[model samples]
Target: MILICKPGSPVDSAKKEIRLVEIEPSSEFDAEICSRFCFVSLDHDPLPRYTALSYAWETALTTEQIKVNGAALAVTPNLGRALRYLRKSDTTVAYWIDAVSINQDDGEEKLQQIRLMANIYRCAQTVCIWLGEPSESSPLGMSLIGGRAIEGEPHELLCGQALTTEYAVECAQALKEILSRPWWSRLWAAQEFALGSASVFMCGRQWFDSTQLIKDGTLNMIVSILSIRGVPAESLMLLKYVGSISLTQTTAIKRLWDLMPSQKPSGRAEIFCEILDQCTTKLCSDDRDRVFGLLGLSPESLALSIDATYDNSMTEVFESLTINLLRHLDSLLVLFTAGVGHPGDVEYRSGVRVRLEDPYLPSWVRDLRRPRLEWMFPPWYGKYRTPFNAFASKEWTYRYANNQLMLKGLRIGNIPAVGLGTVCQSHFYRPGEQADGRRVLQSWMALCDVAGRERGRDPYPHGGFKADAFCRTLYGDFKTTIIMSGRGDFNSVRLQASDVDAIVQSADWAEKLAQYSDEEGEQEAFSIPPFIIGRRLFVTDTGYFGNGGAWIEPNDQIFIIMGCHYSVILRPTNSLQSCTTYRLVEICYVHGIMDGELFDGVPFTGKSEDESTEAYLERTEQLGDHVIEPVCLC
Candidate 1:
C-alpha cells in the first residue's frame, strides 16, 4: 500500500491529511524492491517518533529512482544511498523525509512544511545527516574523531596536549576529508542542524557522533593539524572549504540564545546583525531564503510577519526586510556596509569576485542577493575600518512608503576641487619609493595650492606654510591642533626639518605609512588602484579642503544625510516644484569631514571675517528657501 496525501485544494488545510511510507529494512541495496505506505490523519491518531533526513539536493544526481509501494519514486543519488543505508532485512523503519513525506506538486503543502519545519525536526527522535558515500579517508577520519570520544570527556584528545607531527599529519588528511562534504554550505542544512534535538551523521554504512563533530573541538583540532609543517599542498587546498555554520544556526540547536557559549549575549537586534553579517556567503536555491532561513533562529523575527510565502516577489521580499530592519533598528548603519565599488565592474578584495550591474536596486540598499562583499576593503593604505556610530540616538528619522525612502538630513557644501585619478597601471610594488610619504605630502600641497589659487585666498604664500596649513586642514583638532597665530587660526603639523632631506622632510609621515603597512601588508599595489586613480582633492565652498573619492566631481553635492553613517555625494538634476532633484553619484571617503566632528562649530573666516556655518545658513535663508530634499530612489 502507498499512502498519498491528496493535493492541497483551496478548502483543505495542510494538516488535514498525512502521507506515510513504510520503509522495509534490507541487508544491501536492491534497485527493483517495492515498499508499503499508509495514510493517517494527525487529528485522530498519535504520530510515531521517527528520524528526519537532512541532506543537500544535488541537481546532477536527481534522476535516480527508488521503489515505493510497487511504484518508482524518483530521487537524488544521495537520497537513494541514504535509503539503502537506512534499510534492514527484517525490520521496517518509520521515517519523515521531506521529499517523500510532503506533496511536492502542491505549493500549499510545501509552504506548510516549511512553516512546520522547526517543529518537525524537534519532534524527531534523531536527525540523520546524509553526507553521501564516504571517501577512502573517511574511516580513518572517523576513527581519529571517535578516538577523542572518551568516557564522558570526548574532546580530551584535542585539548589535552599539542599534537605530535605524526598525529598532525593524520588529522590533516582526516580534516580535509571531512570538511570536503557539500552539506556544510547549504542554507537549509544550517536550519536543519539547529532544529534537530539529537543528530546522527550518516556516510555510506558508517555513523559518527554528529553532535561532537559540529559543537565539539573538531574544527579547532583540524586547524591545529593543518598549521603544522609538512602537510601536502593538495591537503591544504582541501581545508579551504572548512567553514562553520552561522552563530544563529548554532543558537537554534539549543532552542535558546540568551547567552552564546563564547560570546556575551546582547539584544535580538545585535544577534540578527551578527548572523546576517556572518552568513552572507551561505548558499540557498531561492533568493528569499537569504532572509527567511534565519527567521527561525532570530529571537526578534516575529515582529515582521515574514513567513514562508511563495507568492511574494523578490523585490517585495527585499523591501520587507529593509522596512522591518528600519522599524526594529533606529539607525541605518547597515547601509554603510552595502555593496559598492567603481560604477561598472565592482570587484571584491577576497572570496569569489563577480561583477554585479544591478540598476534596479537603490544605492542606499545592499544587494543581499549578491555574494557577500563583506571582505571588500576600503581604499586606504593602512586605514583601520571601524563601524560608523557617531550620532546620538534619535538624531535621524526614516520612512519607506510607495517604494521610496525618505529621510531628514542636512546639506554640508559643494565639491569645488578634486585630486588626480589613478591613471597609471595598477602596481605590485614593495614599500619603496612608490609608497613614499613625501609624494603624498607633495600631492596635498599641490591640491592646497590649486584650491587657494582658484579661490584667490592664498593661506600659504611660503614653502613650509603650505605644508603646515594642509596638515591642519586634514588631521588638526579644534581646541588643541589649531592655534590662533597672529594672522588667523593656523593648524600645526610636526614636520622634521632635516638638513640632508630635500622633498618634504618628515620622519612622522614615514612612521604613519609604516603603521599602515603592518596592518594591511606591504604588497597592496593591486588592491586600491581605484582609490589611487580617483584620489580627487575636494575643496568645499567654505574653503574646507580634504581628499575625497575620484568620483566626486566639481559640482557634486556633499551631504551629511541623517540616518547614514558616512557622507554621500549626490549630483544635482533638473529642478521640480521649487526643489532641486539629485541622483546618487557615489559614496565618498573624505578624510576629516567623515564623522561630522569638523563640520559642526569649526570657524571658516577665509571668505568673510567671523562668518560661521550659522551665518552662511542665515544668509541663504535671507536669499530664499533652499530646501535640501531627498530624491526618491526607485
Candidate 2:
C-alpha cells in the first residue's frame, strides 16, 4: 500500500519502508494501522446539532444587542454556537481547526499545522474566546483568569517586571530568532502574558520601553492584525491559562491604566462605572498631574467644576448630586406603592439589603443555591454560618441574618463584591418619608501612618461635615462602623473589632502602599508625600448620589453617583408627595479635572434633563475607537 502526505517536504533520497495516504476533506479513510502491532478502531458520527446550532447564533448576533441575544451564551455555554452566530453575520468567518481538518496523519502535517496556527489566527479579523463551556454547566468562574504571569526577567524601568503580553518562539524561525536576542527580547516580549491551552499570545505593535520606544517588524505583524482586521479571528474567545505579573507589573498596571484608552461605550450605561469603581487610587492628589495628566482631566480642572453654590470639596459633586436626586425619586415611588397618601413618606436610603427570592435573584444564582459569599462572608464563616453568632439568636430585632439560612430567602452570599453594602441595621424597618435628620456623612481619604506619626479624618461636602464614619485630615481616608448591638441610640453604639476593622480597613491603603517623606534636603527625585487624616471633614451636600448614576466618557472624563441610571422608573421609598422632580441629600467631596486643565466639564444635555442624562452618556461612549484586546501568546 502507498502512503501519501500533503505538499512540501524534504526527502532527497526518500525512504521506501514507510507508506502514507493523503486524505481529502470529506471522504472516509482507513483507520487500521497494520505496520504496528496495534490496529485502532473508531466509531463515531458528526454532531450536526452542535454545528447547526452554532451557525444560527453567529449569523444573527451583530445588529442585535448582546444582552438580548439568545441566552445560549449564558445557558448553553457552547462557544461553537456563538461562533456560528458570528459566522452568520460575518461570512468571511473561517473555521480554523488544525488537528482534525488538516489531516494529522503524520508528524509532517502536525508540524506544518503548528507552524501555521499563529499566523492563521493572527490574520483573521475577529477572535472568539472559548472561555465558557459548551454545556450549560462549566467552570467559567474557576476558569476566569486575569493578569499576566510574573517573571524575574531583567527589567529596565521598575526593579521587577510583570508580564502583560506574549511572544511565540517555536513556530517561525524568524520569530524564534528575534526572541533569542537579549535586547530584542526585552524590547518587545519582555513583559507579556501567555494564555490558552495552546499557549498563544496576542500582541500589538506599539510598545513603550518605560522611557524609550521602538518598533519590531515581527511585532508590527501582530499589531497590524489588531488594527486592520475588521474583526479578530476570535470575536470573544477566553483562554484557559491566565497570565500573572510581578510587583513591578502591578505598579505598571496602575500607571498603564491611564495610558490605556477606555473602550468605546456600548449600549450599557453601567459600563462607565468600572473605571472609578476601583476609584482613582495608587497616588495622592499632587502626583495626579504628572501621571494622570495624559487623560483629559487634571485634579485642579475637576475641582473647578464646582457649582458655585454647591460644596467645592465635594469628592464628586455632579455624580454625588445626581445620585442623591435619583434616590429621592426612588423613595417617593416606594411611598406611592405603599399607598401612603402623603408627601412625608418619600425618601431613599444608602445600602439596602438585596432580596433573593422576591423573584429578584437571577435564575443561575437562585438555581445554584449560592449567594455571592466572597464579597460579604469572611473565610472563617465556612460553608455554613455556625460560627456567626449574629444569626444564633431568634429575637434579635435585626434577626434577618437568621432568615438568610433558607435557600429561597434573600441571603447575602459569601463572596462580597464592591457596591454591595456591608451595613446591616436598615434591613427590616423602612425609613420614614421625612428626613429624620438621620443621614450619615461620608468621604474617601488617603493616609500615611508611620509608627508614631499616623493620624486620621474624613473628607466630604466642602470637607466640613466632620462625619464620624470617615475621618479626613491631611492624611488618607479611614472608616469605622458604629453598630448598635442591643437596643440603643447612635451615642449608645459600641464598636466591635470585626465591625471597626471593617470600617478602618474599608478605605485602608496600608497593604497596597508604602510610607514616604520629602524635603528640600531630601536627595534628587523622591516618592509621593504621605497624608495624615486630621479631623473628620464632612460635606452637608444633600444631593450626593449613593451608587445610582455613573457615566464614563471615552474622553476620560467620568461621572458616578448611585441610583437607577438605566431604569426610568424610580424605586419605592417612604414618600409623602408626588413631585415632577426629586431631590437627594448627601455628604462628599468632588475633585477632578478634564484633560489636566482647571475647568469643570459640564454633562452633555439635550431637550429635557432626562434626555440630557442619556445624551451626555451617549456622547461619552462615542469617544473611543472600539479596538479589540490582544490575545495572550507564549
Best by lDDT: 1
Give per-model TM-scores: 0.67, 0.20
* Native-referenced Cα lDDT, model 2: 0.21
- Where does candidate 1 have its weakest 10-residue lDDT segment? 481-490
lDDT scores of the candidates, listed in order = 0.52, 0.21
TM-score of predicted model 2?
0.20
List the RMSD of every prediction in angstroms. Answer: 10.1, 25.6
Q: Which stretches of candidate 2 lie over 4 Å from their true place?
A: 1-195, 202-538, 541-634
Tens-digit lDDT track of model 2 for 1-634: 2223222232121221111112122122222111101111111122111110101111223332111111111212232223333333322222333222233345454433333332333332332222222222111111111111122221211122331222111112222222222221110111111101122211111111221211122233433332233323332111100011122222233333333235222211121122222122212222221112111111222223323222232223322222222232221111111111111212334663223222321111111111111111111222122122211111101001111110100011111122222121221112241121112111222211111112233332223332222322212222222221111112222234343334344443321111111122222222211111111221112211121111110111112211111111111222343211111111112221111111123222222444433233223121121111110000
Clash pairs, model 1 backbone: 25-88, 25-89, 26-87, 26-88, 418-537, 419-536, 419-537, 421-533, 422-533, 534-550
Clashes found in each candidate (C-alpha, N, C closer than 3 A): 10, 131
